[model samples]
Target: MSGTGRQLAVTADEVVDAELVDEGAALSPAPADPGATPAVHTDRDRHLSPETVAAIEESVADSTRRAYSADREAFAAWCATEGRVPVPASGETMAEWVGYLTVTPRKRTGKPAGPSTIERAMSAVTSWHEEQGHPKPNMRGARKVLNAYKDRLAEAKAEAARARQATAALPSQIRAMLIGTDRSTLAGMRNAALVLLGFATAARVSELVALDLAAVEETEHGYDVTLYRKKVRKHTTNAILYGTDPATCPVRALRAYLAALEAAGRTEGPLFVRVDRWDRIAPPLTRRNKDTGIVEPIGDPAGRMTAEAAAEVVERLAVAAGLSGDWSGHSLRRGFATAARAAGHDPLEIARAGGWVDGSRVLARYMDDVDRVKNSPLVGIGL
Candidate 1:
């Protein structure tokens, strides 16, 4: 088989042809018999219609499809470089790919990919084969390789317990971050609302960016934010109550942010928007400056913030507050769970508050450090 040096950008018909050739099915027409009548149709002639194929493709989420495509392409590139067939790849070949990913220096960082990254790439390879009607690659060898890699890390005392690991913002840390936010500008107000509301709801960055003004209902106390979709559940809404302190209140901060948007005549679309370098919200297409006599360029009001942007927000805040540790989008959600557990709340309550559907065990991971100290057997004993 010839390597294309990259994934073959073939159409659906080409894919079908390739599969047929791979299966050794006859593509030529049978010899015509002038004397014979046309044979009756049978079940063997039945096949999926175009509509069915389209529906099948659309069933998977767009993000998942994109990830699978990218992963497959990367694997194909690797296979080309190694003189291996990506499609119908052997178990041995898959294992070799795993090893390569583990040790190969990345172009940008010059560091080998991590275990999780390797696993995800492997999964992508498996998914592509399955989609093309090929037998799934026997991953036993790959699994063994990963297990051995992990064992080495454990021997070196580098493997941390998954449950005991989390980068969370403490209350004081959050307060300092809030104080450091310059709320006089549009960007500052948006960032403040983003961080505050993110912490209060324990929402994932994806969820935070997915919020829309239409889904927000003002309540007597604070506000009710409706999430149309989440990783765990399809749809759910959470109530954010007003805080006693105005400066630290997520509800109050959100209200102020909304007021700013309203003043800009933005009453619809995404709750959070992108602010330009000049600290101004991009005006809508229909908006015009009456005094300047110039039409302001329209921006995407319905655009959702990317996860990278959200992580940058957390990192910026952490640095501004002089707090250390690799802070990311997960800090807000993890921080809420950690802080709640430290406040002596029940595990179940914390789980519910954080939208954890897998029970207390999932929530327990965030509070491992707190649990170690609070539930320690030697708490009363002198060191």
Candidate 2:
């Protein structure tokens, strides 16, 4: 629902005044009845119009609301499976949900729900109940279940946290990997550009794989990469990214890959594509010669790459460079944030580059983790 330049003077606690409402009939709609009557009783007159409800919903940021919606949907599905009510959830239902989330592996990461994740889920459920005008679910039992799980996790907090996160591909390790890569090979050139660009842009695997040939524009300073992703509003320009070293430069690596593809008659389409075991982006596009009825190799257009494929590049390159720990595409992003934080760069700059929302907990955690070891006064002193 939208309003036509109507103003509602709202403060932290209550609505102060409503403007441009004198000439209109107050359309108080409800979720149960979208076409609710504007009729008012003497005793009960507090009703929100659809527009007002929408405005209220917008109080929460769109991203957070999206997460809450997903969590609410997941909880509803679980409730259906367990033969229980989701909205007006009882204490026992909430307890079981907490236990289930603790043990159940997530679809994306294949790990048990973290404490933060569980907490978010609970918040989503509470929001749902409140929206339905029901009392909050008694979560005393749920809190006990969560407390027990947290107690076990507290035993090795550092180890558990580290184990769950993708290992940061630090600058030193990146230099090693870049130096170790053989640029002579097509795969080598592609892999080098993939990792370096991933690091430089702090791009997610999905965003990296979604690039097209036209997305990148070469300039004298460096490349201006225009990325369009959901995390990014419209498109983002990662401009003037320069590397000090020749061997580790993303621009040079990308140029080499583009040159190789052009030689094979591929100058357009997907920026990153599947490179087969035989070191081929694709067999040249073949067509039958109608006159002679003979098929021949034509242009070399390539297939698109997947997010998984992008991640494997990071893991494979890290392994080849003899760097230890579990590396994934996220390593690039995490590494960039950590390194920038360590170098005393502004938090907003790091967050903007990584497409992290303002006041992100994960971003704070990454910086805090770096601060911890160096914080002690005994660190520099050989104790």
Candidate 3:
């Protein structure tokens, strides 16, 4: 089924040994059925070995299975230390046992596992136990523990927020980033277009990279972009926003890029294409030759750029502009918001322009020196 909730016809089905059992199996403490009891068979005849457990996990997604495997391994080690049964734990026993994992020093890191990590371990083990037809431990308490951990994280973020009103590249810094780009060449033009789009729209690096040739339209007022999906929210509609009135900066930058793209004879698809410094069309960086300077067409022309690629573009531009430290792609988005507010745009107006769900989230992220200066003591004290 798709997210629209429409079920598609199944073409084929693969059989697996483990079946998804009833949800009640996790809480029920009795055998599956009360009908005429079949002859009891003890595991002494043919016990399920570690190899069998590992094989069962192979059917799940790689990430999910790895997590479950890690959790089970941790629990098995704990069982060996406590001299308890290495299999299905009773409700009371699991509660008592998981409590120690919260404070127990990790064997590798030699630091106590945090509550959230421990809770995940418990959830994994309980899920496996339930799958094997054993009554699983109560998990409502685990949710409470996880919530408390989340609260701590929230508090930490709040503390950091107090120390810093959002900081982004200043006007001088933005000017520097632009000057740093090699504007004499096609590569330079592409880089300029990338940065300009990000700055004008306050777009995340993901959104900027996902743009297709068809999505951009030159409007009478300015360049209007239609982004299909923005990470800031969950929606199916296109994000329509005017890039600046008259859109000279972004439009000029884009025109240079498009001219280069057309000259290279790519007219029908992606808005951006990678070109090497030597003017050769090459492939993406790979493990074998990642350091070999090559630019390849990204497979998904409308998909987000790799975080590494985005960072590289920003860092290179920042270095060109004569700044140091890890200035990443995100700085452009932050740069736009900060610059807009500095220009005296209202908070709600800025938020609306930036496609923020509300002004608070925008304020929380973009509030900075401009905000402080505009509302500062010096502004009104003399009068």
Candidate 4:
């Protein structure tokens, strides 16, 4: 954090929560000029109540905040080297940055930015300027640069769609990932429960993170989940019976996770809370100790997992299990629909199962691919 070009591979998950959640992470100037003022007005607006402050910080998702923070750092670094005004970046400055991203591979992975990543970075730049009470920098030039970069990505066209649509992972693939984890650890237990529950219910990232302790009920057969809210128009409850496999059973996995939380004196609250690298539940949020002049993880726990964090669970697990693809958050929902259609479930039944509007074109799209392959007339003839 101190250097302009220090170690650069650190991911957002590794950074402290304060920078990711609260708008405290500053867009600092060059490391050579440590005396330069910070972009965040640390002393301003001190009269806001504790609850009000918390609400404002919580207004944005933690994942988005972390992304924005990283964007700020990247812009600051570029500006520091180029001697441009970092805060009130001109439209020309923004356009140049987009052009830079178009050619420059990421420092960690050495992969070029896709259209979506470039667009998000643009949003981050504008957002930081707005947060600092500056007028919105015109991004028309930036948009032009982005469009040109996208046109040059004909070879990457398939890869570009990945940000918008994730490849589905069937039940077998999900089961393999669930079974591959070391459930003895707290993180492992929570992750298994999350992935399985998501696959079983076909829950979207938003719905999965919104669940409270009271929302899930354990019954003799399985678990009954009451989804009081849904992303789609339908608002209804859902229930699931026990899994056939003990090693990857959604009900059993959830039970183990609940038991682990109970042992930690957490009886009722957020169903899924933050877990740190130390395998500890709800690690104290991070802050710099006033006296020590060093940053430290401190303060109250950030209880529930953000939707972005919830979505990452599957991808992390997939990579650990050596599986690869455009698999991610939406994969769980898509996978459920795919699996159900393969099982000969009716389109209406599948639609209701995942909270999609009945007779929806979206649902049909999910079903069509399998139907074409499974019901092909050449299948029995053994092509």
Best by lDDT: 2
Q: Candidate 3 residues 212-261, lDDT tens each? A: 77777766654677653343443222233344433226777877777777
Off by over 4 Å in 2: 1-83, 100-141, 156-163, 232-234, 283-302, 373-383
Give the Å error, residue 242, model 2: 3.4
Better candidate number, 2 or 3, judged by TM-score: 2
Model 3 root-mean-square deviation: 11.3
Cα lDDT tens digits, model 2, 1-383, are: 12222212222222225743643445743244557786555523445666776676555445466677788788989999999998689999999999999889898878888887788788778756655557789999999998888888887673433236888888888998777778888888888888888888888887888888898899997788877644434467777367788777778878888888787677788888777788888554679999999997663345777787889889888898889888889999899899888888888988877788778888888988787875766697987
Residue-level lDDT tens digits of model 1 in 1-383 = 12221222222321334555623325555676899998785654445555555555554445555666777888888899999999899999998988887677889667666666677677777766655557788999999887777666567675331223447876677788888898988788899888888888888787888788898888987898887445455566778888777877889889999999899877998888877689776544446789997876544545455666776888898898888776887889889888888999987877766777755465776778689999899998998
Q: Which rank order by TM-score, best down to worst?
A: 1, 2, 4, 3
TM-score of each: 0.75, 0.68, 0.53, 0.58
After superposition, candidate 4 runs with Cα above 4 Å error? 1-164, 286-302, 358-361, 380-383
Off by over 4 Å in 3: 1-167, 233-248, 283-307, 359-362
Residue 10, model 1: Cα distance from true site in angstroms: 20
Q: After superposition, which runs of candidate 1 have C-alpha atoms over 4 Å from their true positions?
A: 1-67, 154-166, 284-304, 359-364, 381-383
lDDT of each: 0.74, 0.77, 0.60, 0.76
Question: What ranking emerges by lDDT with the best candidate at the front?
Answer: 2, 4, 1, 3
Worst 10 residues of 4 by lDDT: 1-10
**Model 4 pairs in collision:** none
